[model samples]
Target chain A: MVDWIAAFSMPLIQNMFIVAAIACVLCGVVGTLVVVKRMVFVTGGIAHTTFGGVGMAYYLMSVFAVSWFTPMIGAAVFAVVSAVIMALPAVSRRMREDSVIGVLWSVGMALGVIFMSLMDRSVVTPRSFESILFGDILLVGNTELKIIAVVTIISLIVIATLFRDLQALTFDETHAKLSGINVTVMNVILYVIIAMTCVVALNVVGIVMVIALITIPAAMSNMFTESLKEMMIVSVILSLIMAFFGLIISIGVDIPPGATVSVTMGVLFVVAIVVKTAFGKITQGKME
Target chain B: MIPIEIKDLSAGYDGRAVFSNVNLELRDRDFLAVIGPNGGGKTTLFKVILGLINPMSGTVKVFGEEPVVSARKIGYVPQNENLDSEYPISAREVVLMGMRSKKGIRPFYSKEDKEAAERAMEYAEVIDFADSRISKLSGGQRQRVYLARALAPEPKILMLDEPTASLDPSMKDCTYDILRKLNKDGVAIMLITHDMSSISHDVKRVACMNHRLIVNDAPEITQEMIALGFHCVPELVHIGSCDCGGHNHG
Candidate 1:
């Protein structure tokens, strides 16, 4: 088994493991903000919008030579901008928030489809498009792994430095504002971090399942912990473990890693819920 | 000294006005309970004071400075509207957030800050539930936790929007008693309440507000005053009855 594991020929598969590990760690850190702010839907909105950026990059690459990092950077910037717009009217008018999110989600998906359709068929292959949709782990290179590592480290540092402020904003905005914290600034910072996570996870999980990878682990961890710090730690551990297991299984079965990872997270969430319910009932019985 | 002064303040939402040409002065240590009908703009007026919403035209001054400029000096307890009850945060953590707006990016809480939070919890009578999750608390306990969170900043002026709404009679009394005690301790309070009869005896003054302001001098409310304050519209008066059982409306 050790010799077989060593015999794995593809360098891209090693890079894929490195990239997935980095992405999972980053998701664990930044996903806490998305969960605490109740911005799970907003993160979904941003993830969907990133497809438009991907389409734009693909179309532009046909005419102008573009590096691999260009599309990811473009997608990250677009996602952050979309997050800012979502936060604006949503924060001001309480009633129109959901409607605004829905409209933005539809617009983003529509823009992605339109841009993809406009691209020349000869330059942008259907298989390449399929790779973008479901993610191709075998395509991850050393450069992608490096980028993910830098992003994960920076995001973790920022989150650590601003953890208290984020906690305050998450628990109570008005109270945070009254204490002299600029609630708007904190919210914008959070969205930017979330956008970065979306961009990083896009390569690993694809657009459709990025939100699940970001939210599900956090939600599952919530069943076991009370403190935000504990929730974040548990969430990261859960995400990494799930990612490792999913990658191994995908390699064995020759299946898509993103779908496997998402399914693993979903299973974990269901198990968490059931176990939490049973434990709660046992505690109640003991109390009686 | 008057911590808050509203001079000829006429405020409302959209294009229509709720209260117009209103004048009020809240001195330090004044626990002014704003008792009026349901659609009377009491909460709107407080929102205007808090700078959450701008008044169509009027001046609101806190400590002789604009309300927006001196936001730190004032704390607010908003009505419990759509707060996810199942959110996993402790009561102490909630109260600690009150200091976050002032602390900014300090990244660490000082001994003084922790003590202030503890004192606020004690003042709000929720110190016992400090480690408990907010979702686990009862309505009365949750209300106190929110109050503790607001008071954690040690603001000179505290504004509440319907603090007693949907609470039991005993809970309402307990909340009011705590407010009365805070007022005595020199924190000027502006409470927007629908429970007029219960709060009328405790408050020093009352203002009847609807589409416009009608500042009344009398301590006790009368049926005639309710008629004039609500613009004598039978439909508007009918809506007021559903709020607190026609206590202030006769």
Candidate 2:
């Protein structure tokens, strides 16, 4: 094996690992709520739908010469707007949640494609749209790492500040409302937080693979935890392990980092389910 | 002090009137069982009082303040079906949720808050299951956990929506006994239930609700009043004086 220790000396490789660590932490913290609240589909919608913003930004840059605007900003804005659209109707029974998600997913992707098609690639920094679909983690730079770090800190602070209210809302929204939590406002805040997470994590896992990183570890952790807090801690640890292993494997095999990481998570999820089932059987036998 | 006062409160959703022109006053230390059919405005009334839904017209005041503003002093137990059993939460953690409004940007619960959670669990006789996962509990046990959660914040009034809908008869008796003890302790109790037989003699004041409010039609609810509230003879009406049998609806 090539000396992994020497590879750490390269700033790019170093930044990649740091970014992975921070991304995994964010996934673990926010993904627990996503799993418990059954918002995986909504999160997926936001991730795929954010392409609309990405497209809008590129289109603006090509046509209007708005050189300062970036796809990241576009992605963030699109993600927030779509999340609000999908989430508001969900709470009020105005529309079925699955239908809302399905509609947004398709429309968002179509908007992104249309925008990208209309852009002139020569005038702006060329980021391959395909790379965005399946991440380019190897090319993550200092600026991307800084952005990720800032988002991670903000997410932690927001989650910490609203911990109890969030707990009530996730467990029982009506109870949360009666507790004077302003459930609608809290729901909106959660959607925004999910939007931010999707935008920041897009750099590490991309749109196609972000849901796997956000949910598989959380599901695995849920199998072993009695409380949401415990689940979050366990999930963070599992996500870090998967990301590190997946990163090393991708380098060794010369494959796409996003797909490798997602496959690693999928394999771990299966392992967890098997182990939990076997452990349950063994314990039941002992009890008998 | 009157813990709850509703004056000409008319509320509904999606522009349909579930109830209108209602007036209600919940006296201190009173155990009022709100009996009605499945969708005959009982829940709408509860929503109005809990400030979850705004009224189309008129006004609702809890402790002489707007219901939304006074929500902190009102302990509420929603229907058991509202909570997902698959969620990873302990009984004690669920109880601590009752103190969320009181917590208010504090990063952690204080020692006194912890004591109150413990005390509430003890009151509901579920202290032994404080650390148990809520999903592992029996239905009756889960209901008690929810009761403890509602009691944790120590509100002047406790509102329960369909607390005994699917429980066994013995469990139903236990739930009523707990509410009676809480009522004796000077906490005003308002329960919304379809099965009037589940409520005991301790619940002297009954509010019959249809598309409108009927307050104190009798010291005890009459079958005629139940018929009015149900709008039709229910398939399985479970009142002490009624003779309806178990009839399944498809």
Candidate 3:
């Protein structure tokens, strides 16, 4: 049997557990709105743009000697700016959202690689660079963990306060606007919130794979729950379960936790589909 | 203040105009019907009146104030509107959303707000499934929930954009009956429809639209008006009567 106590004693493993919980909460809250708003593609666009932020953080830290601009802070700022650009009606009206996303996606990735190339090798170690793309929970330090926690708490609070407005907007915009919610402003705020989440969740799933964490659990919960409130609760719980188990299993197997976690949820989502479909068919047969 | 007053209105998307040089003046207790073809700019007119889009050139007033300021006084149901089938919501919550204008910036509902939602749900005949998931309900049931949501605000005017577009004939009748009841109770109604059969006794006025609007005082359907508004006669079985009931076509 594995020495569970010894594993728990390790500070690195302990940090991994903490990240699992916080990241799950962050994912659950933002993800439910993203899926409901049919903004998965928009989210996917933001997730990729965050890599540009990570690269800029590293570049500014080493080259420009900006000590305060950590990757999380830099990513947060970059993400918000990008999200606002994406949210702008001017941008959408001038060009299709799909085309805009494509442009931003390519530019962000290219910028990331170019910025990494300019950085000193000592600052851009292969493992650390890889960590920016596909996350490693072991890479998170005390500061990163604190940033993730603070951001997650703030996100949760905002979601709680504006839950009604977001709910109405997501379900039907025309009605929400008539009911006195500023639809355009609410949309921009929601986008900014999701962008910050993408930054905070970087250590858990990294930039490239972040959309899976943001979408999978909420979509899975949608199968079981009817109300947005219950769906959010169920989704958070489901995300926590996936994050915890995925962390432990990856630790045991000596694999990448981010990849393992994403795979775990992806598989569970398929299982849910199969179970729901089979159950539906069986009930229909019984009725017949 | 007139409930709705518009003059020389020209509105559309981009640089093109959908409808131009239109005018309207709604009475305090109007039961007006606006008729137009599918692409003849019915929805754009609503957008202008709802303060969703700025008009290229015109003036619009709701209850003597700018439409944006008086938007709360109106309850609107958009055309062919459907929430995501898998969306996480219930009828009661949707109904409560109607009361948002009353409690601005305060997200939580008060006791009175909850009671109003109840009254709306009862009126719409959807109290039985008030707790049911919106996605779980059938088409007709979902329409009633939308109606309940609109009615909960207790607006001075109710605007419905093809509210019964998806319903069967019987459901359409029920929807019109509810609208008539609301009108009789002194709430003005502004409904958009493509159906000529809606030229009924309850409608006090008719506005036909193509690239412009013509407000008809006599609530009667004329072949000339149909030809002008629709741009062409609809290619259907013109049995001289509408399919829903024995409403005349000629």
Every candidate's TM-score, chain A alone: 0.91, 0.96, 0.95
Comparing 1 with 2 on DockQ, the higher-scoring candidate is 2
Model 1 / residue B152 / CA error / Å: 2.0
| Interface DockQ of candidate 2 | 0.60
Score residue A7 of candidate 2 by CA lDDT: 76
* lDDT-sorted candidate list, best first: 2, 3, 1
lDDT, model 1, position A7: 31
Cα lDDT listed for each candidate: 0.76, 0.84, 0.82
**Where does the lowest 10-residue lDDT sum fall in candidate 2 chain A?**
A84-93
Expressed as tens digits, the lDDT of each residue in A4-68 for candidate 2 is: 78777888788888988999999998999999999998999999998888898999998898866
Per-candidate interface DockQ score: 0.49, 0.60, 0.71
Candidate 3 is scored at a TM of: 0.94
Q: Candidate 1 - CAPRI tier?
A: acceptable
Q: Which candidate model has the greater lDDT, 1 or 3? A: 3
Q: Give the TM-score of candidate 1.
A: 0.89
lDDT of prediction 2: 0.84
lDDT of 1 by residue, B30-140 (tens): 777676667877878887787767778889988888877776778788786536556678888878877765565677888888999999998888887788877777766
Residue A166's lDDT within candidate 1 is 82
| Order of models, best DockQ first | 3, 2, 1
Model 1 spans with C-alpha error above 4 angstroms: A1-4, A7-10, A89-95, A117-127, B216-219, B228-250
Error of 3 at A155 (Å): 0.8
